[model samples]
Each structure stands twice: as structure tokens, then as C-alpha cells.
Target chain A: MHRIERYYDSIFTKQSPEQLARDIMKKADSSAKKRSFRPLAVVAAAAVVLVGGVTAAAATGLLNINELFGGRISTQDEQFAGELVGAAQDFQWTTSDDDYVINLKGVTGSERDMLLLYEIARADGRPVTEYMTNIPEDGELDCAENLGFDLNAGAFKAGNYRYHYSINDDGNIDVYNLAVTDGDISGQQFYAEVINLYPKQLLSDFEAKHDIFDWAGGADTPAGFYRWGDNEAFDAGQPCDVALNDERIIGLELEWTIEFTYSPSDTAKLSKVITDEKSVVSLNYEKSYGGVWTYPLLRITDSYFSSVSGRIDLVREGYMRGQTFDTCNDIYLLLENGDKISCTAFTGVSSYDRHEKMSSFSVEIQYSEELNGPITAVDISKVEAISINGEVFSLI
Target chain B: MQGDEFTQYVRKYSDMVYRVAYSCTHSAPDSEDIMQDVLLKLYICEKKFHDDEHVKAWLIRVAVNRSRDVLRSVNKKRTEELQEGLSVSDEEPSSDLHTAMAGLSRDHRLVIYLFYYEGYSVKEISKILRITESNVKTRLKRAREKLRAFLNDE
Candidate 1:
């Protein structure tokens, strides 16, 4: 192994935990000062300030300003609805006393936008709590949180927009109070859900039906975990979270691979005599998976392919021109003993479903013995910088 | 809950929080900024920690989300980092492992850091990330494989 001790030392020297922590605390203190001056008389009744000092109160892992600005605190008692904005313009919402009616339209393709709605209500007229979108199993079931409001974590597929709505316990439905912001919006919504886990029950049932599971109970000391869900799981048309172990967490795509094969041909090499017995062969391999992915958003990049000319290129070219000229598939070059050998490569194919719902995914192609040989090694070039839903998360 | 407990917790988990911030933003200053933000946030959240799990999850999520925000502030920031020959010290690898990690995607780097550096299980990571457990495992495997490929390359 090539040890880069100097490199590691330099990197560590650049950062110190104590200094970083102190800096964070100082920023929070400043933000807290700004928050303190904001008059809370209007919403004070609806909300409560649990902590007073930013620096003095060290027990709460929450910064002083967090309570002031962490979540979208809706303290309004009156019901008001705003126009659906951004990518959710396609959905139509109507409010009823018991439920908020939502019908989506104008979806031309399979892609959709993320929707996060809070069902706000007062308990005995004192704001008991705002239950996160914890909808019951049946679509019509009433969410028994404060105000009978059904909080929804919505991801609408088959569209270019997002939608939001709310129903107060007084039977007044408001669907337009939804706010939209770009960049990791879905993550923020998920963060809200994490803060309130009561809605896990509602999501748990949804995932139970629409979610796909890996092999369960595989070992006494398990190396992994598993879950299952069905259709409504992907209904939002965007990626949403699901409770895997009776805990509500966002579903994600688990990747698996299978071998694919293709036959080789000598159609391109006209110089080679058409021998009756010595037939040229071409082989192709495809790699893919079988499972529903958890992420609500999925994207694919331009595929790249390369092969050795002298060793494997001859075989690959013969097969390509003669049988199937699919340059889209990976074919590579191999060099050995001054002979050019042909090889193939296809990697880094990723699936980003907004909601981790797909059950199975794989690749298929033709196969041949002429393409098989004792491999001395392998070579692959990686490409990074692919974006996932505005967050440059990773394609690997 | 006492001064001693608070101090102990801070000392023990400060590195974890810093690493989380570093992985998310891939910048030393930003990571430091995130750590500071998280500590203060924790200080005020007053939502009592049920156990270490709850606190860990809260810190990691806040650091990650804050770092994500930092990424958004300057579009030119990431663009400049990716451009050739900037030699930004933050981007330098601490070890061959770190270099390989720097070369990875943000998600890959995050998963690797949390799993290997912080020593969290896929389940714990899933909770901390609000992602599925299997997703964490798959990412870990792919990250390891990629790291192998990177390290083995001459």
C-alpha cells in the first residue's frame, strides 16, 4: 500500500474540533440575539419558547436560534390557502371538513415534484401538538393528531410540479399554505418528519403495501436488514420516506448485479476468409440489478465505452460489425505480449427513484465463448460530479 | 444534563460532528462552521435526548443539512473547486484513503466517512441520514469497491 502519511497529517492539521465547535456556538449566539428581538406576542400563544439563553443553556443539543428558525412554525388560527407553486402546479386541491381532496392532472411523463403538507389543528383550543404527516392506512382515515390534521409527505409522479394542503381540526381545510424552496427541499421535509415520528404509523402502512423487500431472516447474526411495501408507496410520483423497521426512514435503492451475454460475429473483418468451421465469435456482457430503489429521484448519465484494439478489439469489432453493432455496450482493449486484445466495460449505471419503490432492475445481452478468456486483470475510469435533485450527492 | 455530562458529550462527539460536516461540505472552513452551528443548535434544542442515538442522529442531520446549505450559497464555489489546479487545502487527502475519498461522490464520501471513520452501522447510518438501511449497505459496498480500484491504480 502506498502510504500518504504526510498528506493525512496535513489534512488533520487543518481542522480542530474545539475551534470548530466554539465557532458554531458563537454564530448561534449571534443568531439568537436577532431572534430575541422578534415580537412573539402574536404567535406566543400558539407556540412556546422552551429555552431562554443561547450560550448558558448547553444541555439542549439544539442551538439557541434553532427554536427560532429551525422549522416552519405555523401559528395562524385562521384557515388560508395559497396557490400551489413551483413544480406542483399540476395538482388540484379542494378542502372538505374531514379531508382535503387532491386530484393531480396534466402529467405528461413519469417524473414528478415533492410535496410536504402539515395538517394543523388545536386540541381543546390549546395547540397540543402538530403531528407530522402521519396519515392512516385508508386514504380516508382521519389523522388523530392535534386539530385532526393529516400531515402528508407528498411526492407526485407523472408531472412537473409539487402541491401542498392542510385541514384544521375545526373541519376547515386549507391546501395552499404549502411553501417551496429549491435545494435539498425533500431532505428538509424528511427532517421535519424525523422530529415528529408519530406519523410513522401512517407511513408504515403505506410502505407495507408498495415497498419491495430483500431476503429476510437470512442469518442469526444478520449482515443486513429488510422491508416490504406495495403500490401507494410510489404513488406520490416523487421519492418519499418509508419505515423499514417499524421506524419511518426514507426508502432507498439497493443495487444488485447479474451477468449478461451476447454473441460475436465476423461481419466487419472481410479480410478473414469465411471458414466453414473456424467461425468468429463476439461476446457482450450486461450488468444490472433487481430491486425497488428508495430514493424518489433517479437520473442516468451518458454511457462511456472503450476496448483494446490489438487483443480484444479484433474480436469485439468482428462481433460488432458482423452480428450486433451496439457500441452503447462496453467493449475494452487488452494488451499482452505485443498482441492487442479486445475487452468490454460498462459501469456506474445508477437509478435514482424519488421514492424507493421499484422491486427489480437488471441488464440483458448476448453471450459467446470466443469472448471468454483467462483474465489477467481489469481497468476502469471513474466519472464523478453527477447531481441528484440539486444536491451533488453521488452517482457511485 | 449537567455541566460535566455536557462537557463529556461534547468532547466525545465533537470529532464525529466535525467529520460529518467535513464529509458533507468537503471543506475545512465549512466543516468548522457546521460544527459550530450544530453545537449551538444542540445547546438550544432542549428536546431531551432519549439516548445517545437521538443525539447522534440530531447532530449528524443538522451538520449535513447545514453543509448542504453552504453548497448552495456560492454556485461559483463548487465550480471553482472542480476547476483544475486550485490546490484548495481542504480538498487534499489526509491519507491515500482520504485522497480516494476526496475523489468520491459526496454521498459516497459521506457513507464511507460515517461507516468507516465514525464506526456506525448501516442501520445507524440509515437513521442518521434518513435513508434506508439497504441503501446504506449498497453504498458502503460500492464505495469500498471504488476505493479499492482507486488505491490499486498505479
Candidate 2:
């Protein structure tokens, strides 16, 4: 037998077809699980913070930041994250309320933004997938339709986007939160807390009730994490530390509050920050949704392109329901030697229900071997036109 | 179908369905999920087949389509580990060829697996994968070249 075939044969032989068949039959035979609604606050909360330094990579196999930051950041962009590895001073404490454990993996930043990396897992070690059954792809589920947090770093406010996660081999769900802010928060002692996990409908209500977005620096009205829709008075849209009553959130239950300090001076020392608003270009496409065509404008508001990865901020008009493409999808970089490079992977972030009005997203693009093309770590200096779904926007 | 018939059908082609799914996804968990889903569809599906080979081809097509759906739903690569729950032999062969095979792209890997391992011809593979016969041969040629390059580098 050929060596390649033999190698796979060994691996494939270990699988038990009978066992898999039995598992399948079991799920088929079993009835759908009964849905439960247990309002929060009265769930017998047991929350604690186990402060384990960023030696998580030393303890765990890998940080898995690439997995979380996939398609959004470039390989060159990863160098910035790598610089902060094992350099976290006072980071990564675990927060366990009742059912799940949230471990703050590390805190990373540039002069413009900061990222609080953390993972969530069941306290009892059951696969979180069993409960968060709606999404089984890569063990990912946005348990809360909308997530909000408060990182008490001066002049830096973090708004929670859709929770992007995947279960690791150890059965932990790593969640990524990148908060953009102004000014340098160097040597900042941040009491970073992932304060709320709820839906967007609750978000508008919380904002209406509170009327203000974040607690002004040192205000002491709502202390910490709270259950949304519980006290109606509890800040569902912002960070607070008290759970009243009412069970709105269903899975990965509870708000995570962990205290960690960050100093990005070391990591940011060599980090390159590039911006090009000098070149302005927009592409117009007759976007078809549900057999109806609407002309949507794709405008590049701002951009930062590295040789290997970059982020593009886009403002799009002409909204449609269930738009299935990212701003950076199918982009290619025309190289110096007349070669083309593919924008291999991307993680585009945008509001779920941005209809009619303008919607904007700054998507990160990187290359993975997933594409069947002339893929390379993008050399940004080449003679260039940015290709978006076939229309070329010249960068020369 | 009776309970035993369901079990019998699934067990007979469980590995093949899983292998097809795994080639597209490169994710064991997603592959396992796809396997169960495809088998369940078969159990409930009203279509009749000429024979076991016909049933096998249909299952392969479903597995491929389902894997494509999973990929298109999200443009993200997943964890590359072999599923931790699977029971394996202590004497399983360990080689650089295993590593090189994994390094190939999904299309390349799928075509290579079918052509050389499963003994599917270029024509049969094109039909199974819903691609042109030329596309199958191209992928096979590219996969072989890539594997050779990878091994040579070592």
C-alpha cells in the first residue's frame, strides 16, 4: 500500500463504527429536551476569582488567540499579540458564578484599543455544547444575542459585540472581546468586568432606563454585574455588580467580573499602527436579497493594511435582511510582480438588525490555506487595486 | 425502517460518510455532527435506491453538500485535533506522511483520499464530489505534488 494510504488507515481503523451508530440511534430515539426557564438572581450564586497569571499557555497547551482572532487579524498582526504573551502582569483570574467558569486569559492592547481575552466553561465539566445546542459548528454559540462589558480603563469604553467562541480540546469556551478607545491607557489598573450577557431587545430597554451608557469613572450607583430585566432598575446595558431577580439569559449563565491590570508599553513598543484615509474609494453593487435588488454602497471609511493582514473599516448603505457576505470576503491584493494574493479568512463584525440606515464594520482579513488560489502573506507595498467580489478599487 | 435496519445501514457506511465529511471540514467534531445528520436524513428520507452502491453514493453526496453548508455558514477554520473521545490502537503508525497529508488543502485532500485510498477513479470522484472530471484529476495531481514537496522538505 502507498505510505499516505497506510498512514490514514491506521488512524481510521481506530474508529468504532458500531459505537457511532449506537450514539446516533440514541439521539434519534431520545425525545427533544424540555426547555427550562429559570430566572436569574435566585439561582444560588457562588462567584469567585481565581487569579492565575498569563502562564495559561505554560499551563495550557496554547493560548488559542489565533483561533479567536481568525480572519480578523493578519499574521503580522499576530506578532503584536505574541509580544504580550507570557508578559501579562496581573491578568487571568477565574470567575465562577453557579454553572460556568469564566477565565480571563490575558489583556492586550495598542495605544488605540485593548483586548480582554477570556474563556468560559461549565463548572461541572460537562460540554457547554450539550446546553448551548443551537450552534454546534466548531462548538460556537452566541448564548446571549448581545453582550456588554465595562473595563474601568480611563477614556476607554468597551462595547460587547456578538460573542465569538469555540470549544477547545479541554472543553472550555474562549470568548473574544476587543474594545476600541482613544488615548494611551498605559500603566492602567483596569477592574475589567464582563458585566452582562443578554439580548439586544433588553439592550434598548436598559439604555432607555439608565439614559447613560457607562458609569462615570468612579460612580458607585450600580456597583457590578446584574441580571437583566430582573430589577428593571438594574443596568442591563452597562456593567453592574448585583443580581436582583428575573431570568432573561438562558445559557452560559451569569455575568463575569474579573480584575486584571494591563501595561501595553512592552507589547506596543514594536507594534506597527498604519492608517490610510488619504485614498477614498467606494464600490456599488446591486445587492440581491429575496429576489429584490437594492443598490448598496460600499465605502472604505478607514483602513490599515499590513503585508500579511489588515483591517478595513467600511460604511455600507442599502440594508437587506440576511446579508451573507463580509466586507473583506473575496478580496485580493495585486502584488508588485503582477502576482495576486488572496484575503484568505475574515471575521466581520456588524449589528444584527441594521436595516435601512447605514451600517459600518471594520473587518480583519488574513490568509489561511482554505482558499483555492494564489494565496500568500500579503505584501502590501505592491502595485495595488483592492478587489471586492470582482470590482477593483485602485490603491495606487 | 426497523430499529436494527437503521443501525445496520449506519454501521455499514459510518466510516465512509465520516471520512467524506472529515475531508471537507478537517474538523472531527463537525465531521461527527455531519455524520449523524446525514445518517438521520437517510433514515427518514423517502427516496429509494437501486442497491448498496447507490445508497453509498447518495450518502457521499449528502455528506459533501452538508459539509459545504457548514463551511459557508462560517468562514473560520476549526480545531485540528483528532477527536479526543475516539479509542485508538496503541500501535497506530506514526509517520511524516500523516503530517504532510494534513497540510494539503481540503479539495486536494479529498481527491487524494478517494483516488488512492478508496480506489475511486477520476470519473467516479468527479461524480461523487459534483465537480468536473478534469477538476478531480487536477486536484489529484496538485495533491500528489504537494505531498511530495512536503515530504522532500523533511
Models 1 onward score TM values of: 0.40, 0.33
Q: Which stretches of model 2 miss by more than 4 angstroms?
A: A13-15, A31-396, B73-93
Write model 1 residue lDDT over A59-83, tens digit each, in one string: 0011111121223322121211121
The positional error of residue A243 in candidate 1, measured at the CA in angstroms, is: 22
Best by lDDT: 2
The C-alpha RMSD in Å for every predicted model, in order, reads: 23.7, 21.8
Q: How do the residues A88-177 of candidate 2 rate in per-residue lDDT, one tens digit apiece? A: 423333322245445667656653445656765555665333321122222111432122342322212222222244446554556565
* Model 1: CA > 4 A from native: A1-396, B1-5, B75-95
**Where is the poorest 10-residue window by lDDT in model 2 chain A?**
A276-285
Tell how far residue B141 is off in model 2, in angstroms: 0.7
